[model samples]
Target: MALTLHGGRPGTDYDAAWWRSVFGLLGECFPGLPGGAATAEALGFPWADQTTPFTLSEQGRTVAHVGVLAHPMRLDGRAAVVAGVHAVGTTEAWRRRGLARRLLGEALDWVDERFALAKLHTDLPEVYAPHGFRVVPTHRFRTPPQPPAQVQKRLLQPLRHAADADLLRSLLRLRTPASNRCATADPGWLELTVAALSGALSSGFWHIESHNAIVALGEEAGGALILDVIAPEPPPLAVVMGAAGAADRPVLWSFSPELSCDRAEAIPTPPEAGVLMVRGDWPLGEPFGISPLWEH
Candidate 1:
């Protein structure tokens, strides 16, 4: 039987039923994951005008799926377009059939036509290496124990309006230029980030304001995760953690090491880093950083 290829911009070319099938497959493949139709909608998957979704269907049922996010990034100080490949998956029965590979190949070809770089963070690097992705070193920082004086909770404003989204976009812009490889601070992308973070954390998207800086935070397992920090100078890690009500929980940072606390520890890269590969040449040298918030 021949497999049919379906390609389109979600919410326009495709309908909710299609997305429900895709999300259902993802749920089966990745049990315990917190993503669903609601999460996908929040992440701009349904209304992503700039993104292309490719699906392979057998008898009108989607078996394999991949999403290509048209991400604008700064590479070596030059503005460039990159495809952030994400949500590549196949139904359990479809595994070992090269469906995912075919879907990925199609996505790469699509990206090659319009972008200079294609990147993805995944746990199956070997599966994509043949497709032309190389793993780049990434740094992870662990917060140090906070001093008692810094344990007092600070006010955190929840992201609830378009104004807050605009503020986040500005903060993202302020931080991205400092990194060699980073997603552009487009308003749509920032709103997507806020939605995704809010869905993941019961507390929703949060920001803290200090005299000198503003920071975005996400909560996981009762611990705070630093999503982004916008400040003229790096603020005290303890203070940031305290503001998020994570004084007792270790804060995990995915941003640059320079923004981390002086006493923070540099942890070893995870085994999955081996599969977090990039295909095209990124002007930035090795040891670059990709924030966790921007993974999808």
Candidate 2:
């Protein structure tokens, strides 16, 4: 029995059965991933139009899959298109069948015709290296603990309401690059960033009314981890500290912050989540960082 290959933009080419099968495959491939339907409903939208998925189905059940996110970004103050490959997986029963490789080749062939660069974050770099992908140094930015400054912290409201989601969507639409060095120019990836964080980190959404920013933040023994800052303009470090109320503690920026690299220490990101891999000429020769949250 041969598997059938299906491809299309989500919501456009994928129907109800396709959603169930693909989302089911995703949950099986990655533990603790939120159900796609619920996440989309919470945001009052479907998947982004830029995302195109390819799946291998055996008798209507999706067994292997690969997703391509058309990421439009600003790299070193210029616009670039990146085909972000993600969710490449095959069921255990289908392992060693070369199903994933087939889908990957198909996806890449499509990518080559349209985009110059391609990227993906994976725990298994060896799996993709044969496809001409190489790890690129990724980083996190950090700032020294501030002297206890007395400033009224802004109020932070959890993103639990429709209005909160809408606010984030609007900001992402007009958002300035978190860093002129590297940042997403389109809102789709940002929206997916929040959607993907919908489960464990869903509570991390913090709306700073004063600064007009939606911050994805988490707490750790080290200090606060600002995962990604979504705002028209990346808020000043002071504003983020005030909003997070962490003026006296060291702050780590998972995403590139607006602050000068001189002020924030840049360190190589751990490969715990998988190394960042690329497939073409990366324009940013200088040190730069994009939030892991932006990864699919």
Candidate 3:
């Protein structure tokens, strides 16, 4: 049997049924996850030209999928296009058939035609290494056991409107880069992320006025997870923890090395840590990192 490759912007070639079916497979693979088609829709799928969906089908039924989000970023101070490859999955029945490999190849080809580089975050680096992606080092920070008492007075305002989105975008522009690899957090992406992640994180999207920072936080079986953070400086790790009300819980902060803050422990390229896989010759300098906020 021959497999067919089909793809298009979310709403055009793919409809709600297709989106649900692909996300259904993903939910089954990673149970207890809240995101899927709904998140994609909020991100302006089909309508948003930046995101494109690809699928592999056998006998007219979708079996594998991948998505690409075209993001413009500064690579060593030069404008570069980075394709964020995400939502990659294959139905359990289709595993080991090379469906994913074929789909990835097609996606990369598509990316190559329009973008300067392709990037994705995954724990399974081996799966992407053969495709020309190299592992870029990233750092994870742990919050101190006892947060500063002053943080108790600080508050995190929930994102509620366009103005708030604007603020988040501006904060993203601050901070010096140790390396050139970084995503441009335009207003559209920030709004889409805030809406998409609100359902996953109990706290949803929030910003600290006192510290000029924004964060997406959620709780999982492992305790509290700081999914993303944006700030001028390393806004106090303790304050971020306090703002999220996860002060006593085990908090994992994913950030670039250029951003500094108090940390209980510094993780150096752990296997479990998210590895960046890229295709093509996208030059990266030392001390490079992409924030968790832009992972998907």
Candidate 4:
């Protein structure tokens, strides 16, 4: 069969059956529904119009979905913000067939005109690197023993959802100006963020809303937390840095060193970092994905 590309329309976010089917396929490729859901919601939903879902189909069948989100947030407090790109998935049958690369390429092309940088988290570095993406570091904390700064923490207050058009528009307006920081923060952006926080996957999750952010992590038995922006985002770093502070130390992880301690550094180079590749206007210590949990 000739490989075909189909773009999901505005109203076709996906029906319950469709979502179930897609998730089922993902469980096979990635496994772990809750974690996959958490990652998917964080990455996939951010693209597509707030109420809409961005999907790709092959010969009338939906096989993959990748999100393209653009709003103004910067890297290192610069004027450019990363064109947030995430959640590229394909069915098991589609593996090694170039489906995800094609789908994500479309998303990247769409955002290229509007933003200066692109950022995402993926274990697959070689896959995205060839597509113009450079890998950035994905951070996980050992769960710092004491709050880093102690500014005062407020978890999950409220942000607009993907369904709220007016509010969603407002959020985009607020998010897409600076391109150097990390991640996209639009309305549906926050909805998916909050959605990730609702399940068991949210155990180490923290949404410091007063900081205008959301972050989740699954700590492995080895004491490393796996963090890939579970929710939308928190307030400016300056705020969260003050209140919540870092978790515990003896921490070995991926994200920016600022999230850990003055002594933070990289963990083992993930196979995906070199494969996925991340390129941005701002310089990241690594190229996987920047964490919204702590300010760098």
Leading candidate by lDDT: 2
Taking all chains together, the TM-score of candidate 1 against the true structure is: 0.73
User: What are the per-model numbers of colliding residue pairs?
Assistant: 1, 0, 4, 60
- Clash pairs of candidate 1? 125-275
Best by TM-score: 2
Ranking by lDDT: 2, 3, 1, 4
* Residue-pair clashes, model 1: 1
Candidate 3 residue lDDT tens string, 168-234: 4465556333223454444345334533544432244566767666665655447665655556665
Candidate 3 regions exceeding 4 Å error are: 8-11, 32-50, 141-149, 152-200, 204-206, 215-253, 257-267
Question: Candidate 3 — which pairs collide?
Answer: 10-46, 11-46, 76-180, 133-278
User: Ten consecutive residues with minimal summed lDDT in candidate 4?
Assistant: 287-296
lDDT of 2 by residue, 1-296 (tens): 88999765453676666777777887898764535545654564455344688889999898998988888788878888788897788988998989988998888888898889999888888888988899888777776656433344332332456665666677777777677777777774444544454452355667776667776676544677776677776666666765566756766777566442357777777666467899988877766777766776
Least accurate 10 contiguous residues by lDDT in model 3 = 152-161
> Where does model 4 exceed 4 Å of error?
2-4, 8-59, 79-81, 137-202, 205-276, 283-289, 292-296
**Candidate 2: stretches off by over 4 Å:** 8-11, 32-37, 148-159, 192-195, 198-201, 258-262
TM-score of every candidate relative to the true structure: 0.73, 0.88, 0.70, 0.54
Cα lDDT, model 3, residue 95:
89
Model 3 TM-score (2 dp): 0.70
Deviation (Å) of 83 in candidate 2: 0.6
Clashing pairs in 2: none
